[model samples]
Every structure is written in C-alpha cells, then in structure tokens.
Target: MLPNGKTNLIALDLGIHGDPIKALERIVQIAKSGVDDHVVARELIALSDGRAETRPVLGMFLGGAGLADSILYCRNQIYPLGLSNGLSHFLTAIAVLVSLLFGIRARFLPPSSNPVRISLIRDGELAGRFSVLIVTTLEKLLLGTRTGESQRGNMKLMAVDQSLSALLRLGWASLFRRMGKTKMQGIHLEQGDTIRIEGDHSSVILDGELFEASEGHPIVLRSTQPVPFLRLAA
Candidate 1:
C-alpha cells in the first residue's frame, strides 16, 4: 500500500489490459515520481518487496548532513556532529549512490532503444527521437504457439524520413494529436527486417519486426536481439 492509500492503482489498471509493457512503464514512471514523493516512495518499496528501501534511508541521512563540511572535517570530527556541517555533502552522496544504483540496474535491465532511431529509414533520413520501453509482456496463443503481445502490437505505427527534421515534425505532430497517430511511413521495413543501431557506447544490428502498426500514428517494433539504450529494454 502506498502512503496515500493508492495501492498500485495505476499498475492494477494497466494489468487489466493484460499488458506487461504498460504495467512496467507505469512502474518506472511511478518510481521516478516517487524519487521525491514520500507516499509514492513507500508504494514503490511495497511493490518492489522492499528492494527499493536502501537508498532512501541513505538519502535522508545525507540530506540531513552538509556535504562540504563532511569532507573537510573527516579528521577528528565527532561522528554524530558530522551531520551538522552543510547539506551539500548529503546531496552529493545521494547523487552518487543513486547514480550507482541506476547504473547497476541498467546493466541488469538494459535500457530501451530510441524509437525514432530504431525505426530508421534506409535513405539516410532521420525521424524524430522517441523512447520505447516494454513494461510487460502478454502471452497469447497465435496458431497454437504462445507468443508475447507487445505494446507496439497493441498500438499504431508511424514511419517518417530518416532525417532529424522529419522526425521532429512527426514527433511534434503526434504529440499534438495526443500521441494517437500510428502510421508506418517513409521506408517500409516489414517484420523480420535486419537493421543496425549506432549508439554512444555500443553498436549492434537488430532484427526488427513490426509488432504493432497503428493506422496513422507510430509503428512499434520488437527486436529479436535485445538493445538497451532507451527507457525500457524488455
């Protein structure tokens, strides 16, 4: 239960749709929000089965202490009075700890890829940049084989030129339309298409498939090989 009594309301609502991606997305969103909201933080701790509690305590301790003072007064300073120096020390510690945790989580749960970049055109044109994360995976029987239904499969697909300008235009237009447009345009790459992604730390080729094709908005893609650079990787 959350401190506000919202016991996974958002996640429950998403689960009603039997969509794991949606559920996970909601979880991440909620977690990000809870970084500041105590109520939400409590909810996350509950949902994560206590896996999310460590950093908050550390945060509270650091926040109550001053960062600069802690560093300078390390020698012969009374242990308890150390917190009375300045708040900067606590803030810095919290930042470093949080960053480390995030890095570890990213390694375990690779980030998602940029939607716009992943759905690139072959003609050197670039579309707007958007991030995609799979919150949940829904199991469905297709031709007697159990397959996962992805968020893209539930939504629309939009295609645009592989140019930054084209991407911006499409992205803004979609945002204005309440993110309802999903039409795969520009270079048409069907399901099972092989493509390469170049990122800051890594470059890899992925087998992309059209998981969801919205009539007029965006096309969701699923990769046979995992790529983590976006918000949601799974």
Candidate 2:
C-alpha cells in the first residue's frame, strides 16, 4: 500500500504506462514541492523491483557522494545486487550515452515555420479563408492519372482558384502517396520560394514569381495563375 492508500498495482500500472522523465519534468515545470525529494523517492522505488534492483547501486556510484548525500543519508545504505551489478551498470551507462547522442542530433534538425496567410473573396465579396503549412520540399513528380499514383518521382503542386480545392488535392495525395504537399503563396515573398495559405481555408503553394511596387512598396500580382514566368518590376 502507498501513503495515499493506493495499491501497488496502481503504482505498477502508472510506472509502466507513464514516462518517468516526462513526469519529473512536469513536476519541475509546475514548481511543485519536493521535486528532488520526489525524484529520489521514485528512483528508490523503481530500483527496488525484483527485475531492477541493481539501479539503486548504479545511481549511487554514478551520482557520487554529493548526489547520494543529497538524496540519501549515507553511502553504506546503497547495496549492490550481487553479480547483477556489473551488467546493470554497463546497460545504464549505454542508455545514458545514447540519450545524450539523440539530444545532440535533435538540436541540428531543421525547424518548421508557420504557414503564410491569404484572404479569400468570392463574387466580389468576402468569403471564408483558410491556412496550410509545408511539410516537404517543392519538386516535380510524375504521377499516374488513372490511379492517382506516382509513376516516377514527379510530385508537383496543383493550381486551383479556391483554397478548398488545393486542400482536397493535398488530402488525396496524402491518402494515396503517403505524403502531403507544401502551400506556396502569400504576402512579402521571393521568387522560387514556397508559402502556405493561412486564413480560413488551409492550403499550400509555391512562388513562381513576385513583383513589388518600386515607388510605394505595394504588392502587385503579375498574374492570378501558377506558372513559371519572369516579371520585371516597374
């Protein structure tokens, strides 16, 4: 029985399903009481299981006297689990090293940005709008017309007047090709750059060309069509 009168079964279930590291992080984030104390207590409990008894000994050795003093009363209190101690220490060290390596890798990964915004007007009046973000690169890929499957590596964006149509195409491609296309269009963009529509309707498109007002910095659309063309600003 726990101090809260809950059975060990509950604790076992929680330990098995919940991530200890995440829970500890949440406790620290919330500025809760006895964070260090809770961590030490949970660590002691986790190490006492029949299959994990060697953890306490490994923690004591790796943590050193200072950590042990902060968490426990004396070094003599931590007992090794006989022959299992050597194997357990080796496994623990390997796990710690692997976690550190993954952390470093994650830091170098590319960051994802929010999609661009656009307003939708229908019949010369304001209608609903939508937004979308890019998840992959912009490239041309040939796909089968009948099966709607990629025959080669020719995946490209589809042009549509309505934002919903673009979203539908993306959803279809995701269902069939196992991937989604990036939206590319909206305010203050550059040539060959991709932009996402973020308003009411969600979609993604790529920029073929851009024209800025020379004197007043006003946005000028060369054409309301998606095509590879050149435009010189006046």
Give the best candidate by TM-score: 1
Question: What is the alpha-carbon lDDT of model 1 when measured against the actual structure?
Answer: 0.27
- Show model 1 residue runs off by greater than 4 Å: 1-162, 176-189, 193-234
Please provide, for model 2 over 101-214, each residue's C-alpha lDDT reduced to its tens digit, 9 standing for 90 to 100: 353222222112112232112212111221222111122221311213321222222222223344445446545763333443320111211212222112221121111112
Q: Each candidate's lDDT (Cα)?
A: 0.27, 0.24
lDDT of 1 by residue, 120-160 (tens): 23434333322211111222111111222333322112233
- Candidate number with greatest lDDT: 1
Candidate 2 overall lDDT versus native: 0.24
**Cα misplacement distance, residue 188 of candidate 2 (Å):** 22
Relative to the unseen true structure, what is the C-alpha lDDT of residue 37 in candidate 2, on a scale of 0 to 100? 32
The alpha-carbon lDDT assigned to residue 141 of candidate 1 equals: 13
TM-scores for every candidate against the unseen true structure: 0.20, 0.18
Error of 1 at 5 (Å): 24
